[model samples]
Target: MASFFRSAVSPSSHPSPQQAAAAAVAAAGDAAVKNLSSTFRLPFASLWSQSAAPLSGQRAAAQAAAAAQAAALAHKEAAAAAVHASRQSTYNTLFTILAVVATILITEQVLYRRKKAHLPGPTWTIPIIGKFADSLRPSLEKYQAGWNSGPLSVASVFHIFIVIASSNEHTRRILNSPMYAEPCLVASAKTVLCADNWVFLNGKAHVDYRRGLNTLFTRQALATYLTIQEKIYRSYFAKWLADPSPAPTPYMMHFRDLNMETSLRVFCGDYIPDEGAKQISDSYWLITVALELVNFPFAFPGTKVYKAIQARKLTMKWFEHTARESKKRMAAGEEVTCLTDAWVKAMIDAREGSDKLADESRKVLVRDFTDREIAMVLLSFLFASQDAMSSAVTYLFQHMADRPEILRKVREEQYRIRGADLDAPLTLEQVDDMEYTKMTVKESLRVKPPVIMVPYVARKPFPIDPSYTAPKGSMVIPSFWNSLHDPNVYPEPELLRPERWMEGKDSPAELNPKNYLVFGSGPHYCIGQQYALIHLTAVLGTASVLMNWEHEITPLSEQVE
Candidate 1:
């Protein structure tokens, strides 16, 4: 290996060859070093320059965290703005609702205010308390003022809308439409006459009960009452002349008392003791006063109800006593003389007799009425007759005084009908024969009715006049004055013309048949109408014979008060 190496080295050992090889190797090595240094210097310089503001991963992460925090703050601000906007929107909605509610209340008040403006009433209503002042102090002057306000007007008292039907047709409609109206007899009616009285019955109950009462007013029964009434009138007429006077004082109270006496005697025979009758008559006025058109509808002490209750207690005792006596007498087989006896006897006859209750004609046979029931029925009759008869009596006296010529004719007629025995009990035919007296009574009633208007409640909403519908629960009144005073029917509405009935004219016939609501029109009409007419006729006839009566007319008397 040494020898071969030496041989090879021998050629390399030559100075020229070895030196040229070394120079080439050294030059290549130097060029490589220079390139490496140049690359390294640039990279190192770049690294050194970045090191002045170095960005580490941790620093980048910290910057990112800061940005996230800022974004979260921005989100919180945006959410807060959204919540604030929502709150503002809620407040605006609430404000709008309050405004709307306030507007509705204001509108209702305005409408209510306007409705009361045009009515023919006081200039300024007492705010929400309309007509209460007038209601508390019901004056005749105030009533007339209200009447003359217009043909139709309205008033609100205790929230009761009273529509005054001044015309006869309207009044008739109010009374006749029993389905639409029921009599709200002054507030004291229920108290004076017990609440369970048949007069308070309505609809089918009223009709059925009234049917039973029809027998009591039969032609024969009326004849009996006529005899009793004639006797009572003759006696009372003599008493009127016992203490004589030239000028007439107000006889309204006297007439009312006379009528009450007659009513008690007629209904109860001798059962109502003299003292009891006088007490009942004297104290009855309290009932009248209590039964005012407007009254406090409560039973509290000192109220109308309290006073009426007292009156009822006093009268009911007498009536109940009469019923008990009548029942005992009837049970003992006593002969029937007066209305009570006759009624009691009939009831006994019916109950003992073999009569089918279902047979309408057989039902004409009176059933046994309880003492309380009889008392209530008697009270009903008294209530029905009291005001109306008093009014008729007053008008009769007034008419006789005002028109002396008419009184003379009536006196002549009475003398011709009852000859010299003026004290004799007049028969039904005799009472009927006094045609002029009857005519005068009718004329007087037409001119000045006792009860001006009959009030009825509308049971359902009624279409009264085509222009206006009666609001449900509103009063719809129809007046008889229109029919009685109609110019077309009477020719002279203001004049006291009695020949209208005698002449049988078309106007008279029209007014007489369908339009007259003097005793009411329906099944609920006055049951004592025949007896009432006969009693009035007897009184006037007897007065014509025995006493000369006069009326001191007053401005207030003719007025509404």
Candidate 2:
């Protein structure tokens, strides 16, 4: 079984400010409740136990007992009358509540069937939270079991109907059919990624916005980002070599920090300080935890959603500041240094003559975006890629550590291209020339894919196939695993075999292009796929040359959580 590397990084290692605060409060509340409940219960129990004890003096006790019995009979009669009235009232309230709940459930069931007509799914969903208990502790095997049931399976959470596409045909159809579906992440996604972020755009708006932003991740753009990325990689690798852990500790967080620093430097560069990058990198874990496939919708105080919102505010504040500074420098005719500067230059170049801006397919290339808007776009990119990339980075290390032969292959290619010049900067040609490194990265992603599924919401009646219709407004998730691991498409799909990618047309992997849904498909597919691949290849290549990491094997390491 496989797992989403997003949550695969343990949150226990890096505790966010909000998470710490919430834990402290919960602990205090539990202690107080425990003391108060014991204080009340102990005294009440003692009084009840001693109530029937015998009186000390026999003669006085007889007279007193006779009087007490008469008084007790009167009290009992009065209490019985009151108890009867209270019981009647409580029973009536219970009946009313149960009736209301039954009515709602019945209506929900009716609507579910109406929408589900002819589809393959459950006979009836669990009242309010279908499959939620299982969700609390999820597994890839559990998900795969559902997928194996049929091409499509349905479930509901908080009354929100969900349709999962398990078959390659159904999954690809959902992914490619943007006219009928659009990305609809969990209820809390808007809170974390921001509502107006370009990621949430649909149809033509999404396509148009994506077109303008695609310039930020082009090969040329990646070339520009490479210098900064290589520098960051070296810095982090140096830090890892200096780690204080006595034994092999989980390096997932170390990899995460590297990814965050790389992204921060690549996106904002000199506009952000070293301290700023470290702070954001440490704080980003809360956002990752909050963006899980499911989360409590309301951002109540002390909730993961609330902590993530706070983290987002901090990250965006820095991003917006960087955008402003980049705009100022670019307008003043300064040289482009980082991604922000690169983006600002792109906007400026779009106004200039036909060099890079001459692409006529762009409807609006030169449009000015506000500082907040620019920051939001950067935030969206981070939101979409960070945890997934972190996963890749972690697995990249583990895979390379376990297989020195492949690592040797990657190293050979790196050295061949760089020509023993360790100090020389990484160039785009070097990155592209490392074909074996690219294959290694690709195979790692396939074996331990960063993202498992992309959640899309149906916009209209989607005739996904002749047999079933995807209901409007329901979540239609296109699972990537089924296609990526199709036995016919990838012989020994579970094995970490990079050669499969280069085995020519006779290779199942090369011929089955559709099976490689690594970046997804259609309109909402990852716009940064090439940038991600090149970045991973370069980082792994550099690591192979610079450092040696030994992956510690644990029983649970191979099991997906």
Best lDDT goes to which candidate?
A: 2
Give the Cα lDDT of each candidate: 0.73, 0.84
lDDT of 2 by residue, 1-561 (tens): 112322443467776886667666666776777888899999999887676454435667898999999999999999998999999999999999999999999998998888767666778878888667777888988888878888888877777788898888999999889789888778789878888888888888888887778778777778889989999888888887887776878888878888888888888888889887777887888998887777897799999999999999999989999999999999899887887887888888887743776474234667788899899988888876788898899888899999999999998887888996887899998888899999999999998888888888899988888888878888899988888889999888888998988988877787779889889888888888988998899899999999877877887777765
Clashes of 2: 0
The candidate that wins on TM-score is 2
Instruction: Estimate the TM-score for candidate 2.
Output: 0.82
Name the regions of candidate 1 deviating beyond 4 angstroms. Answer: 1-125, 136-152, 244-248, 353-367, 505-512, 552-557
What is the lDDT, from 0 to 100, of the residue 556 in candidate 2? 78
> What are the clashing pairs of model 2?
none
For every candidate in turn, the CA RMSD to the true structure comes to 13.2, 32.7
Candidate 2 weakest ten by summed lDDT: 1-10
> Residues 1-561, candidate 1, lDDT per residue (tens digit)?
324434544565455766667655666666777888898999989887787456676688899999999999999999999999999999999999989877865654454445434556544444455677777776655666666676666766555666777665556566657677777676567766778988878887787777666667777778777777767776666777786566657778888888898899888889987999998887777777777767776778887678777877888888889989988998898866677787777677667763523344246545567788888888878877887798888877877888899889989998898898866778888876888888777777778776666666667776555554455665555556666666766677778867767875555645456655677666567777788777777787778778776666667656544
Q: TM-score each candidate.
A: 0.74, 0.82
TM-score, structure 1 vs. true: 0.74
Q: In model 1, how large is the Cα lDDT of residue 400? A: 81
